[model samples]
Target chain A: MNIGSLLGAIGQGFIWGIMTLGIYITYKILNVSDLTVDGSFATGGAVFAVTALSNIHPTICLFIAMFVGGICGLVTGILHTKFKIPAILAGILTQLGLYSVNLRILGDKANISVAPVSTNITFLANVLNIPHTRAGMLLGIIISIMCILLLYFLLGTEFGASIRATGNNEKMIRALGVNTDNIKLFGIILSNMLIGLSGALLVQMNKYADVGMGKGAIVYGLASIVIGEVFFRRFSNFGIKLMSSVFGCIVFFIIRAFVISLGLKANDMQLLSATIVVIALAMPIFKENINIRKVGKINSLNEMKQVSSSDEIVKEKIEKREVTEVGGGNNA
Target chain B: MLKLKNIYKTFNSGTINEKRALDDINLVLNDGDFVTVIGGNGAGKSTLQNVISGTIMPDFGTVEINGINITKYPEHKRAKYIGRVFQDPMLGTASDMWIEENLALAIKRGENRSAFKWMIDNNNSLFFKEQVAKLGLGLEDRLKTKVKLLSGGQRQAITLLMSTLKKPDLLMLDEHTAALDPKTASLVLNLTDEIVKTSNITTLMITHNMRDALNYGNRLIMMDQGRIIFDVAGDEKKKLTVEDLLQKFNTTKDAPSDAMILG
Candidate 1:
């Protein structure tokens, strides 16, 4: 990719990478495949557009967008945790419902361009008076670093620990006297809040928000997470994992930019992203199945040793019985 | 400190698979009462613990802990008063969390957990290392290691430590050592006894092993078909022999096949 295009791709990646952090909470930590991002992303953009049209501060609009997105997640969380709905279906339902909600926020219009811009165009450009192209790159880096730091600290706190524990073992957390439903609700809320903030940033960068802005957003998020995990699989520290996930986002966007330059059509983008996510998701399961084909897929050497020792004991007993019994050779 | 009054529960009610899991069960545990429960598969031993822990609510009964009606409370709410370890080592502790982190979570049992304070504070971490050191499994030095990397015995020990950290009003162990090897199982059972003795926590343990049932607790209870068939304690329980228990177990034709093999 050309230098300018590559920088632009990185900028776009940083915005989506913020959303990827949200997905990390639901997908990796909370262990819930929240499909709400497809809708929550648009909800964020819609809220930002509506609030900005009313002459609100851009930063305030970002908070409003996140608040709206968090509500969407709260709906999904309640449905899954309390109303007895399956998690995926609950997220799907919220996502589907947000279609009309997003439309309403957009004043029943499909698109709202930030023309004759109400406030200075980009966050970095407005605040730092930097060139537009450089501002884009700078904005991405700043937001990403901010999110990584916040998440690292949050996940270290008691509430965050319980939330992670809730994702890790629901029964264990509940046994430890944590009201797990509340913890899950908070996790979903926090995750979608970041996703909404990312959406707001995307709208500012593109200078327009569309009703279909969130289409395939979940695929991208998952792709970013998978890519990040593939590269940082060995880093167990929470901050490193978050930073790598954002790094994954930047790489994913840059690669997409390069492929587009190679004549990939806009209509084909969704299909390509979907395929990438499917492959990433299936790789681990495929590995397990391959292992299962080999002697019951013993996970560790300790188990293998146990199995072999049991076999040796049986062999020794048969030999001992042969020596003690007459005509044992005929029986064998 | 714990009471189950006429607890009745049924699964798949009105269906061909309908079976009564708890049949008007009544139980009372005094503070520091360490009771061992023995039963065959599907004998409702697990169902009893589940009811107490609020994982399963009795269809028609009241559960009271320390004079409060807890039958209507949710499972998480009841956790404030109850500690539990499952047969599967994975169930009692978060595998992804560190060994010390697991204990940190445990120490907060029955307390507000939504605070924003640092989870692994120096005070808590030091306390965890010291408490784990007492297990004598060399886990004290590996506080940062994830619980998943530990052996089954180690995981069970950590889980046990977690359950008893703050001394729950009642501790329930549902075949906690059944998944471990014989030697490991014995080791965990011994550790369990030590913890119970030192903490003086009220405990209810269900074991498929009849010998363990008779040997570990201050009281022993036998169950068949969702009913407490025999209860013994103190001098009377001490005089009982394994052969007598096995003979008694075999008299019931539907007794667990494995119970007959008990020594």
Candidate 2:
């Protein structure tokens, strides 16, 4: 692939990695299928583009985007937990609602640009006197690293434990006297915040935000998480899992870049992602079945041995009883 | 102490499949009271425990712990006062979490806010280790082991210990030992008795085994349909046999099934 194309792909992939982290938080840590990603992704981009044009600092604009994303997540959590809506349905409702809200945020435009103003990464890149591609990559890497560190610290906290427990087993966590609704809300908010921030960064990197930027975002995120989990299944440690997820996103991007270089059409991206996720999800089930078959064979062998041993024991008991009877007769 | 007054629960209300899971159930458990509940399938044993634990809200009732009415309280809100162990060993604790981590969570039960530190203090860990050592299952040495690695009996033992760690106002055991082998079940039951007696915590244990129901607990309750049909205590409960229980059940209802008799 050409250097520019490669760098462009890498930069885009890096931005997408943030959304993967958000997906990891909701899907892996919280163990909930949140569909709010589609709308929230665009929401982040719109918020960032609109805010940045109004003379706000680009970093602050990103923060505002993340905050809006968190609000969207909070609404989804409220719908699911307090109102007793099914989680998937709640996400769908929120996503549907976000479209109109996103339109309003964009002032009825299908897409918007912050080209005339100081874009976050471009400004930073100019100040640093670095090439746009290098600047984008540098910015993406630093933000991702910071995000990962923040998550690592947060997950180590007590509230984080509660959130993890909520994912693993809500009933057990509730029994621990945790108001799980609060934890769910907290988790959703945090997850969407990262997602929105990623969207904001993408707009700055690409020089514009579009209404359809979030399309297939969920699939992309799922692919990353699945790929990461498949790669890190052997690690029992939580820290390892987190690292693997980040690596998974990067690896997914590299693979996508390779596919594009091989002359695959852009439309094929969705199909490839779907296939990857299917394979990743199916791997565990395939392994489990293989293990079960092995155990079943061992159990049958043990059963046969048990049957023979019981029969031998019964025969020995009968002979002993006969001998005792004969000895008693002789004594008499 | 725990009290349930005129509790009524109907599942799928206003439907063809409507079932009155609990009806006019009035019960009071004094501190240190270990009650064993027995019944056949669909006897409302689990429903009663659920209501008390706030998993299921009673249609009409007042559930009070130490005279505090928690009838309107939600499940997570009521968790502070009530400790519960489910029939499925997997349901009571997070399988992926370390045994110590699970213990830490149980220790923090009822706390308004959890501390930020991941590790408990050395002294607290020592105390938990001591508590775990009492199980005599060598779990004290396996405190760092994930709970998923433990056997059903071992997990149940740990769950029982965890539930009583905070000495909750009321403890509910929903056939917690039913999933284990006979030997392991008896061992857990013995541990239950020792823990309840020593801690002086009020407890409600549901069981499918008639012999266990008769052999354990200070009070024995036999539920039929959706209400308590028989309540026996003290010397009467001590003198009771499996045969006596079978007869009572037969007289109170129809012919008791052989499987019910066996359990």
Candidate 3:
């Protein structure tokens, strides 16, 4: 209810934003579901917690966490590409495998606490010479911005275009002389690494790493991406879109804070989030059907196609566009 | 030069869906031959192109391009040596990408995609504009427009441009104009002829339209049941009429569709 509580939510949102940005690479750009986020997120936290306790530099621990997360993605990529497993199932397999791996990393504990001596909170506050209340928000903003800028630049590169093309038309790009399998592998790895990095940072903000911390991470990530597209889709610039993903999390957290202040129990949060996501996802489909009925003249077949290669969410958008196109045919 | 010797392929082998997509295909093309192929659906026209391009491996064949045996190369790896345009307009280009971005991707078709290179080089923008302008679709002015907005005819035109941009060692067109309207199909065919002749790029084009297959290439080949039923070139090809070709096709139980044979 208070400003402090709201700021705390924003801090949490920023960390989630970072993870979604990682999701954005796979879900939005590469067009892969990459369900490895849940497992990779926990791996990152576990790795970060243990490394930070051993007094390794905080920044170095973050890199280590990211690398470990990337390896998880690589494994999923191999399972999908080399072993011919479906992408989502490949990610689920890795996620399930990482459960045991996460236990070992946590020294068989379900949770590990990084106490007051940890380098993430108070240590960061001392370095910045600011109060603990303000340190997290400031760090979150700065790091998120840095991550955004990096993504903006990378996606604009030739290789980045190839990644986008891979999601868009795997066969076309393949005919263009790109080994799409390798491109897919790189995309999955990069996405998981970013998720891992975000997970490591999220644990520090909470001052603890729990085995279950990453549960429903994909839902959270997808919610942020869908919300960002819903609210800020007007801006097509890659950088602004990336910022919008983070901005969406901030808005979502703020909304949660308002709802909680209105007397909603904390236990209802997950249910509320799930419902919101369901609506966000189905809104396009429902709208598309409505448009079809409105037109009333469309044929059974209207040249719609399954060409976007991947991204279940984007596939919905494709259908939405097809129906809209049918209605818009006369206007054009 | 391109060569295919003893290429054999069977899909869904030993099943109810079993099909011999390719059967002992042996072909040789000297540089800049500009051949056209015609066949009905399931005639293995696409399979022959796919085998040469490595889209599908031949069961028993050595595909040699320019005297190098490239049967073992993957599809993308073979891309450095060939250019291809598919029948479906959507299959040849990425729709969501900008007109120029698609060209930039084609420009890097055979090169290693570098992380540091700008996606579309500024220096090449003018060249792209010129190339797009040459399409005469007014696409030059709208280089930044997503390809999705382009009409089927316009997309086919750009796809043709992309295929020949590098003067590929061999250019393959698989019914590239079938999706276009009559007027646009002729326009694209003319463009295809212009691009092929100027570059002198050895090319193979497949068409259901009998006239396009007969008129567009120096050599004309017909396939039926995965076998090249007829092959003719130069004066012999030029003298042939649509009726003669249809007559040749009728000799086989499986024949081209009436619409295609009569086109």
Candidate lDDT scores, in order, read 0.85, 0.85, 0.86
Candidate 1 regions exceeding 4 Å error are: A120-123, A285-332, B250-253
Give the distance in Å from residue A329's predicted Cα in candidate 2 to where it truly belongs.
60
What lDDT tens digits, residue by residue, belong to model 1 across residues A51-152? 888889877888999999999999999998899798899999999999999999898999898744543346568688876766866776787799899888
TM-score of chain B of 1: 0.96
Deviation from native of the Cα of residue A55 in model 3, angstroms = 1.6
lDDT score, candidate 2, position A89 = 96
Candidates arranged by TM-score, highest first:
3, 1, 2
Query: What is the per-residue lDDT of model 2 for residues A183-299, given as tens digits with 9 covering 90 to 100?
Result: 888888899999999999899888888988898889988888777877887887777777677777777877888888899987688899989888877875575556545654555
Give per-residue CA lDDT, model 3, range B82-161, as digits (tens). Answer: 99999889888888789898998998887898888788777888889999888777889999988888888898899889
Stretches of model 3 off by over 4 angstroms after superposition = A291-332
Q: How many pairs of residues collide in model 2?
A: 1
Model 2 chain A poorest ten-residue lDDT run: A323-332
Considering lDDT, where higher is better, how would the candidates rank from best to worst? 3, 1, 2
Give the DockQ ranking, best first.
Answer: 3, 1, 2
